[model samples]
Target: MSQIFDFSGNEEFYHGGSIYSNPKEAGSFLSLGIVNHVDVYFPNKRARISAPLVPGGESLEQKKQVSLDVLPDECLYEILRRLPGDQERSSCASVSKRWLMLLSSIPSADLCNKFEVVAEEGDEIESDGFLTRSLEGKKATDVRLAAIAVGSGGRGGLGKLTIRGSNSVRGVTDLGLKAVARCCPSLKSVSLWNVSSVGDEGLVEIANGCHRLEKLDLCNCPSITNKALFAIAKNCPTLTSLSIEGCQYIGNEGVQAIGQFCPNLKSVTIKDCPLVGDQGVASLMSSASFVLTKLKLQGLNVTDLSLAVIGHYGKTVTDLVLANLQNVNEKGFWVMGNAQGLQHLRSFTISSCRGVTDVAVEAVGKGCPNLKQFVLKKCAFMSDNGLMSFAKAARSLESLQIEECHRITQIGFFGLLLNCGPKLKALTMSSCFGFKDMILGFPLPNKSAPLRSVTVSNCPGLGDMTLAMLAKLCPQLQCVNFHGLPYITDAGLLSLIESCDAGAGLVKVGLSGCVNVTDNVVIALAKYHGGTLEVLNLEGCGKVTDAGLVAIADDCLVLNELDVSKCAITDFGVATLARSKQLSLQILSLSGCSMLSDKCLPFLVKLGQSLMGMNLQNCNSISSSVIDMLVGRLFRCDILS
Candidate 1:
């Protein structure tokens, strides 16, 4: 017989054999039998000559436990790369020490195409840059990070590695940072919040090792000084966005270096760095190749000189935040007003800039035509004159946060709201004592009141009528916070919930200091809108007792956060939350609840890992022993005392 099978089929080749058990058609398997020739084919690939097969003599269980040495390394890698997450890959590595070693030898980047991968769902909020990984708390330790670097041989295509500060991250040091720099050559972004151990030297190591770094966030890393900035200016030319918040030592020299080297820099945020004066800022702006866009300078020492430079060269700027720059007087804003470049400004936030008066504000208002967001915090000097111009010019406004702006009265403030029409979506006027009932009394277009969130906390002048009007006007409001409005009673709460689509849309409701709010409103919420209510805060409402809490515990299964702090609730009220199987509560604040004790701990312990935050501050009856035991059980919860 010929060595090659001469049998032919439509687009199929056969594996031929001199002696065969059973002769079969192209693609089907041939059984073992006495025959002259055997022919078999595979669907996708060309067929080869038949060879004697050896059946696995091992048991089925033994085969599963066997090492992957039988398969080629490439084949094993190909299979492992398809896993969904790191946890799944870790699971595969747990089969044996050999498997573990094999996986450890390969870079995680090679196993997955994505350079950076967020480990959890919440990480999306913090994810920034080309490759960003944000793992909140101490889920990722320095030791673990170092091990990953060593296992992957530093060739991991990771761009960003963000480990948010928590209790465990305090132990991380330069040793771990050095390991990462030595291995991961593709690292572009690194955010180590509160990692004080990493000094200028470690930063230098990163700057030298990863030159492609574009975005860097070193929040609260106090140890890093100007040396780190100098190194970055020399090495990192592609740097664009940089946040050196609370790094007190780096000043003018560092800022000057950034100006000289990083010509492509777009956004630069520096908080609490008083040494960076106008000279440093001017040098940075003078040499910039591209238009400067975003700049956030928040600190007591940031002066008018820097502000003047911003107004002079900040024409291309879209988002401007000059927060906490107390030294920036009305004169600095005058410079910005004259700068015709600020005409295209979209978002303007001058928070805690106490010197900002109506004179400078009025100029900015007249110039900036496309202002989408305007936030004025602690700018008490700004009066109706500035607001009138701002509101008239900024008809495209969507969000307004006027916290601590006492000078802005109903007329001045409403001037902006009146022109907002349907464009307004969020309104936060906390501590604006000027707010009165009439501010919200005016009729708003039901379809045009596109307001999704309304927070008017500490505005004591507002009453039940305002709340009722808000609900009636904005039926789709998802969050309503009128915390310090004492006059908002049960009638308003019920009317608000009933008139609005609270059952379907309202997720957060805050009546924190409404002393008159009672069980009637609480029971109404559970009966009518418990399903959509995720966070319900009745803090300081002394009238809400066990009956109100019990109603919520029984009906609101989806309540993730509940605050009844300073309320007249005892262990019975706290116990109701722990006993409820349906309520997988994440945050429970019982601060100042004098009657709460050890009796409630057992039920709370049942929540296990579900609880994220628990405030038991000033609970005189709850002894230290109960707290100790509770902390031991709920290790992850932020147990505040």
Candidate 2:
């Protein structure tokens, strides 16, 4: 008897006498089992055929798959040009050699246009460069630096490069910088922070290669010395801004080189450089006097002579900051003011300096006629007399900030406020222990001052009477912030807000840490200033409850930002806020409100529709899973849980 066998299924058939129909039978098959003549029919359409295995049992006719590499060069170039950032393009370049070449061939102008498009969509793009790259920590490898140097050649030439920290064993060296120097001639700004591996050799390479360098910021880079600055001074003539902080080896010589060679330098900030003394500062001031507009000297060993030179030669200087200069004396500050060369000075800030005395401050006020803003911090010797004298001298002064000034008593504080010109628009006072409600001798001004904002913080001596006095003095105040004032109550805040002129309404009010503030203040805000009030921060006001939030939701139609953290708010309050039709709040903070739980999740998710930022930190009662779900739903909102 003959049995027919079909090979259409590609199943193996054994030549045994008995039929072995099991397809699972394993072994090589020599022939079909008991088969006579068999005929096969063919279809009209072509069918895929399995090729016979080779000696190694691998198929020779493997299928091919399409990929980005297979695309045309022009197509790849367009794709790379549309990448959001250099890091993304760099990642794509690592895929293949063809991609790297295509990415490098992209024009700089096209990359710049892509950056502009990204910026318009609210993404941060470096202002100084059309292309920017940063290498940090372990990623700061010479190989990657070399790659950036080669890859960024065609993509608008790296506009800015930042190298921060490096690998512990082996990191970026002179070789990497040399590669960048050789390739990126259009480099404009370079920032090196805590990158100890890089020294003068690498910096000089950059200075020699990138002649268009405009800004250089070096912070805690101990390896850098004077030689690099000299090279930059000689080569980079268009250098406009230079900041050197904690670079101990960089001394007067480097600064002097910059002063002499970089005549177009507009801003110079030299901080904590022990070697920088009178000579370097004087040279920089005198040589670059024509165009220098801003100067900041902090933690330096310079003396009065430097200040004298600045006063004499800083004719074009408009902004000056002097901080932590123990070597500078009152004589130096007085002489600087007496020079009368700071005619164009607009803003001056002095902090943690022993030389800031009443005499020096009064002299500065008398000299800088055009000075518009003045800030003083941690000046232990500065008293009310100095403050009053300065206030009287600075006629163009529009803003003043005084912090940690212990000697500025209520007399001097009120005297300065009373003597200040109508141009004064903003005043900030913090940690002034001498401020008190006592105003018996000082007479209040009959007409409201033109001041638009006032911030008084941590002054325990300040009381209700002072707030009433300020309310009467600055009725047109649009912004008020009183924090850590234990003596201030609802009545004090009430007086300040109620005293606002009919035409002038409070736009921003902050009563943070004022435990005595209650829902009454919120009700008052919703009643009088609700139409114009846009920012209300009542954080740490334990007395505030759901009633306050309900009032805010009902009346504060144009409110844009509200902070009720650490208040006695519950789910009902959040639900009320979420259901409000008129409130289009963009930022909301309910951190530390222990009463909030998973039940408030739906309401918060509803509120997240209009919120750009929400802080739910320390709300331990709310489940993490709920927050995770809310995060997935609120794709547009930034939640900090």
lDDT of each: 0.72, 0.84
List the candidate 2 regions with Cα displacement exceeding 4 Å: 1-129
Top candidate, metric TM-score:
2
lDDT of 2 by residue, 499-572 (tens): 88647688999999988999998999888888889999999999999999999999887999999999999999
Clashing pairs in 2: 108-156
Model 1 misses residue 630 by how many Å? 9.2
Which residue pairs in candidate 1 have backbone atoms (N, alpha carbon, C) closer than 3 angstroms, thus clashing? Answer: 21-33, 154-183
Location of the lowest summed lDDT over 10 successive residues in candidate 2: 33-42
For all predicted structures, in order, the TM-scores are 0.61, 0.80
CA shift of 581, model 2, Å: 2.7
lDDT of 1 by residue, 370-464 (tens): 77888888887887667766666566778878888877766665555555546778888888787666644455653535678888878887777
Please name the candidate that would achieve the greatest lDDT relative to the true structure. 2
